[model samples]
Target: MNGKKFVESHFHKYLTEHLNAEIALNTIQNFDIAMNWIRSTFFYVRAVRNPSSKYELQPRMDKDLIDRKIEEMCLRQIKELQKNGLVILNGMNLQTTVYGKLMSKYYLSFETMKLFRQIKGSETYLETINTIVKCKEFSDFVIRANEKGILNQLNGSPIRFPIRGRIRSNEDKISCLIQAVFGNLTLPTPALIQESIKIIRIGDRLSKCLLEYLRLRQSNDSKFRCYKALLNALTIVKCFHAKLWENSEFASKQIRKIGAVHSSLLVNAGKTTIKSISETDARTIESILNLSAPFGNELLLNIMITYPTYLLDISLKSENVIQVHLKQLNEEYIYIGSHTVLIVGDSLNNLLLYEENV
Candidate 1:
């Protein structure tokens, strides 16, 4: 079938299933309810899809009937929002609630918003990642015929989280791919690597959305679960950027000039990843990577110097500012963010840490 017919048939089947289930049409009480409402769009879809003269649609609706249908659809959706606590219908005007605002800020779909609303902000880090994969954004990722083998291969290799049973649905693919990214598992092909990276970038954004949601949840209840979820969200956010788990010895592989082999070798020899290279002598790391005498020092210096030397100001008569302010000890840089950093300018400048705040 053509694209239009295919979409029509898809919706027809969807509506039929909803009808067979005897699902209510008034309010979307949860994610499943919201999804059903989303899928049950046959009536309006047909009305809109049949404008072409070639198509013969159902009996034409008069102006009054069309307006009534429009009103009914709008009211049904509004009721769904009310049921989900996303909006408040006071008299005539419908006002958005905090949940609604949060959903709007993230540009989340109604279905996704419902799912987010249900989360209590107490899930484990792995659970949080799994929850994020359920977003509507990942629904379109088609798992190839042979991709499941690769996913299972990644799971068996060294992923932070592994799945059991058959890998079903795109959500599973996303979750597996994310774990593969964190573990730095060698994807079979570059295409697969690129695909995983794209998913990672999108997943990173959704993870941020969940982080904010958890933070809000914590503020309201102040429960241990809420605080834990917030903390997990924070860690998950950083992991997404670093592309490695916090405990992964090979997390340093994300740095420039560092690879899985380099990290593995260094980690095995009892050296540092990226964080505490300062504690280890440069010569030790150098010898492990098998570089000549001074190159190890140079490698160490290059990597350490770029670890968040803030661009306070870059000065010039051309009105450029300059002053490298070392902010509080954190992986994030004031200018070039992320643990993996490259100081573009001042290749000649040396980085020194001050014991006291400057």
Candidate 2:
């Protein structure tokens, strides 16, 4: 037999068995309503198969009529079942303990048949039902949580810091930079260890400088100016390091690997630049400029160190250059005025030696 004929034969057989003398004579009308309801649901599902398509399921009088009839039939059946002590309805809703088990069994039997047909056609009815059940469970959990409880759970959680740009000294800044560069890939364990080593070395030096400045018997204004400069320099260094790391080929590769595993990471990276740029302290701007001028020159050189061909491109041009020695690195440092910017290869010893000279 053809598919449509087979479906009709089975549907008729089901109605014949269910519509017995024990059921009300009106049950024939209920059976028709139930069949129509199933057909309408199937039609709706087919309409939504290609969500991107312009096609839509329009409301029809036939569908509405069938739905109303089904509701009425179910209500009547519930009433009859309750009267016979086969089920119970408290107020409007059916009591699950009395009617739920039987209703579920009926639903399962019908659904299993529907699923078999769906599977024969290479569809996923069972999977869809399981997904719906999972979604419902999650929704219930979310709805039961109180706002205060949710807030409490989130209060101590770490905020995501957007790492961007370069900086001279902050550990947090360096960490952010490292994350930006290597965050997306399975970085060599040794690379991470090396980065930590660099951070600790830089952090120790910065701490020492800050401590000495703090212990000095300078006037309040002088001390405040020194403190401000130190803090600003640190913040800038951190930002710079984070950006440098993000732009590194190693970091980019890592990010690509991460993107392969988590689709959202690539999307987020494209959408944002630096994660965060701490506001420079207004009071420390001058001090920061003074303390950071030398380091900034060094950083600018470091940026172009890997690309030596870009060195001549960084030299400052113009009328007056008799006094200042312009060790042309890249246009990266030209805006910083007369400060000596030293570009060195990837050698920590060289970097340390240059800093000592400054």
Candidate 3:
């Protein structure tokens, strides 16, 4: 028989026989209700698979999507339960409520049966189950058992299947299971190894701060200290050139270009010419000139020693005698104010430096 037909037949027979029988062991009335709900759910899913529907446009049929659908159905059931005053929402999602949980368990059992059959012949089934068990998350044992049963059945229902020996302790059992499954798996490639190492290094640094904060109970003072520490670390790391700047050609070119401009301008200005002005006045004028220039020329060095970068604008504005108009390359006024300086074609860093000097 075709795969789809086989699956449909098995699903129908299983629902009518095994599932109904299990439900009947509970209250007969609830058995009927649950059976009807399960049947309806199966039909709804089958209908969704029809190419004529909009639901078919959705992505793949994964476990997460199935879980979500089951949750939605459970929520509807829970709402009915709540209306009858048998249950409460309690600010929880469907999966967290009593009625919702019952429905989820039933749905999970059915879904696991389907998945077991689907994965039966796959070479990775045992490996996949081993990984799930090792993770030890919710429903791991149930999933593994179902897979094992299906695999055993597929292998001709052998009277004496090979029994893997269990270890004496739980920790040993988990370790042995992992080793048995993955010991033969090949090591990662060099590129993957390098990436993993980088991730581990970053994680380790973050983990140290995390542990310290956790141990201190993250009090207000502790939090503030952590924040300050992070800022200081960022400053130190940002200043480090070993990993990024590292004698780069770009850095060398920028230094050479700026140094050449500084030498040419300082040479033309002549040492004797600057000697007449008082040192302080010379420094102040140089700062003002840097604020007015497009580049961090000799003017910037003088400004750095004479005036703080923040006071530049205030000092310039106080000079009411000079009306400064900042203009663009086309001589169009971009800004007009007292002591405003026009800088043409300045890089963002150079502009920032000028702003600081001002």
Candidate 4:
């Protein structure tokens, strides 16, 4: 057969009819490349035709044709992922947000894809994929724990705790305690004092109880849920505190003046929440999309290192730079600013700047 005819025949007669019959038949939107490869590879390897096998393959199974088909299938799947703003690579689904930092990238390896196809039928394979996608480290922890027989007696029962009661008074009590301790002590920056207060707050007896519960949780499956809930609550507290510190007026005018010296400091750090971008800034963002980006702690560190004179804002900062001097908390907040550009990240280093418009 000629090249065009060969490609067309495989696509229509084999690919659509054999590999993707269910998808083509139902018009399903959520496409998973690994799952599709698993089903298709199984169909190709079978010796006997099942009731579902509607078409007979050409007697001579050309390996090159099969390889090309798989490649095209992967490309189509990747296109779908791209459209959804997700990335999948090397049998792994890369996280969009890791430990509270944002990253948008995907990767997939040929060998890993082939291995997934081979093992897709295993009972644990799907579970393993689900676990990894949710949190690879957590999945690995569970797997290791299981191998050690830690889960042998697990009934998957829920664990309950009075979380609401514990958290309700945590903020006020912690704040009062902070005020009592550091309220008397003078500090250069109120931000630093606030951070100190947070550190102290985390060390409180109640917080210690939560940490202890998490530690003891490893021995008992019944406590896992409670432990996780407590851990999540504590994390939220930390994030909230960090955000407050980021947005707080500098402890003194001297601090603010010092911060203003930083080349690209994000003044009014968390005041403006960025959801959508204008066409102008969107264009600039597109150019930097491929540039290495930092997430979570790394992003925080980048902000600190690049803008040594400034605070790390919890929210995403605006790209626009304002030349006018900013007033204290009571003053009008302005979003207009020049794009302050700087290198960010220790590993995946990239130029950091704000988007202006499309």
Candidate 5:
């Protein structure tokens, strides 16, 4: 609208038509080259015209045209990924590098991964959030004409981290939605609710991606200062899973079933985290939150097992360098920072920093 020609809603509408199409469509994007997803897409688009015969070839089975489109999509995607260092030409064959492998293995888009590569492990907390909200994953988080006022009202309320400036941009909405998830803020609309849920679902994954990128950066650069940024990333991951800001006064909500309303009750009753709940008798918590007997312990158990534990190993690769690894350990629990949430199965969520000043 502002001289960009197609407003964001235009692109979002097109994406919705492709992704949520009722019939075969060739206008979708990002072909999965090795999986032959492109071939299937092309074949499906062509076959939609002749659905009467399942096995019979279509009236216009232009194999050459389909082949050409597939080839072009493959080369175009691979070139973009390669240009951004996600893909590499190893000898005569094009293959995924470690970065590329992680991105693929984690279901990350190359567009988001490319944005993630810009982080230098020296960003402020706000800077990290700013960069992440702009990733391709949040590109679909469009700001409607009406919702701006709602978002503006929420920004004025006691949000955990009050953002500067007016409420605008898809990134701004995403930024607000993420905080709403963390703060368990009461959203007024289903759209806001669904958006919060989507962001929550991907929050942990994004954290993993960030940590993976940090690990890679630490490995290659001996002088990288990773302690603060790593710790902040870890806290962000914890906040995502815990569904509460790191510095929120209502920390008791981290306990399962103790939502925003009852969270304050627990705090007033001197029960904050699971550790606090563990210390108190079940009857005490029940009396505090007005739940029936034994429900408190049940809630505690849910909190304990609500999220799966990942084991993360942070070992020193050298005097000034640290390598992060997702190892299968007998012990329990870990944490990130990334576009796709550099996640590992029972991995991420740990960091150890060592420096040689003398």
Candidate 6:
């Protein structure tokens, strides 16, 4: 099947099985109640885990994006547990067990399966999930795994089918198992090799997925290509946010400030993807922009990609003053407009583009 169908089929099957199992296990008299509870739980966990969209830069808020992010987040956590030879199922904490529940339907360790009950009424469920999905710990794990050929080793094992592997050493069986999931490690093309190194340095699951997706492509579909382009745009914006956040407290604290920086960066990525759009999609976007948007169509897409759910309002309440409302963080405002407006710039020379009257 096609890429979209592939993702949708797997996701639908997974969701159906999960919801039915929840109803049966809970003995909930009402199927509607069980379905509502299960969906709310998914949304709650998602909101916390993907908080980057709420601050700094806009995260991809699409269901596909959320699903991919959380899956990888949990997967990286599993890889970390495996690499350390920690009994993947041995953890009993509220947060760690979310990983267990998330993968219980799959072939994870038995101990991990046993921990799913810990999440049933846990008070820290949301906080635990937040920490799991947002934590940077997995990035380091991935880097070490890359260096050790641990992923390659696990994929080649006879115990694991379809997926392949190779190993630098048999020092850790769990590491080998982790490699099994990726199948055989083909030599990455020179382009992919460069992409891998860049993504590794960015050190986030999203970037890791982007690199992997690029390496695993065979589709010629335009929709798939656009979807892939959107991923690349997000990777670029996220990496930009990450690097700036690492080096400066201001960038971390000031959401709108960093946003303007990434907005400028996304304009370039947006320009390329704009050409790939169908005329219908293009017109729909144009119609939406015709209603009081400050930026042109391309820049608006940059903003949408950069900050998916944010509200940006332009207020010219005063002749000498302009107000840009970046609604997610109410305390933040960015200044940019017109010719020769005075600019306050960041250390990286990310111009906080605020322009008033000439």
Best candidate (score: TM-score) = 1
Off by over 4 Å in 5: 1-73, 220-224, 296-358
By lDDT: ranked, best first: 1, 5, 6, 2, 3, 4
Model 4 — TM-score against the truth?
0.20
- Predictions ranked by TM-score, top down? 1, 5, 4, 6, 3, 2
Q: Give per-residue CA lDDT, model 3, range 1-358, as digits (tens).
A: 6555512222332332233233334321342344346546554455345312232224455645644554455445445444532234455521122322332343333333222222211223233333222322222212233233333332232211223442333322333222221221122345323433343333233323322322232232322223323222222222121121222221211222233334334434442122222232445434433434334344434333332222212124563343344322323222222132222212211111112112
Candidate 4: where is the Cα deviation over 4 Å? 1-61, 83-133, 143-358
Model 1 error, position 227 (Å)? 1.6
Q: How do the predictions measure up, each by TM-score? A: 0.67, 0.17, 0.17, 0.20, 0.65, 0.19
Evaluation by lDDT, superior candidate among 4 and 5: 5
- Give the worst 10-residue stretch by lDDT in candidate 6: 5-14
lDDT of 5: 0.61
Task: Give the candidate number with the greatest lDDT.
Answer: 1
Model 6, stretches more than 4 Å misplaced? 1-99, 103-297, 301-358
Better-scoring candidate (TM-score), 2 or 3: 3
Q: For each predicted model, how many residue pairs clash, with residues at least 3 apart or on different chains? A: 8, 22, 2, 21, 16, 20
Query: Residue-wise lDDT of candidate 4 within 282-302, one digit each (tens)?
Result: 233323332233322343333
- Runs in model 1 deviating more than 4 A are 1-59, 221-225, 283-287, 290-299, 302-358
Alpha carbon lDDT of each predicted model: 0.62, 0.32, 0.31, 0.29, 0.61, 0.34
Q: Local error of candidate 1 at 186, Å?
A: 0.5
Error of model 6, residue 307, in angstroms = 2.0
Give one digit per residue, the lDDT tens place, for model 6 in 110-187: 333233212221123222222222323223333344444434533444422322334444222223322221222332
Q: TM-score of the candidate numbered 1?
A: 0.67
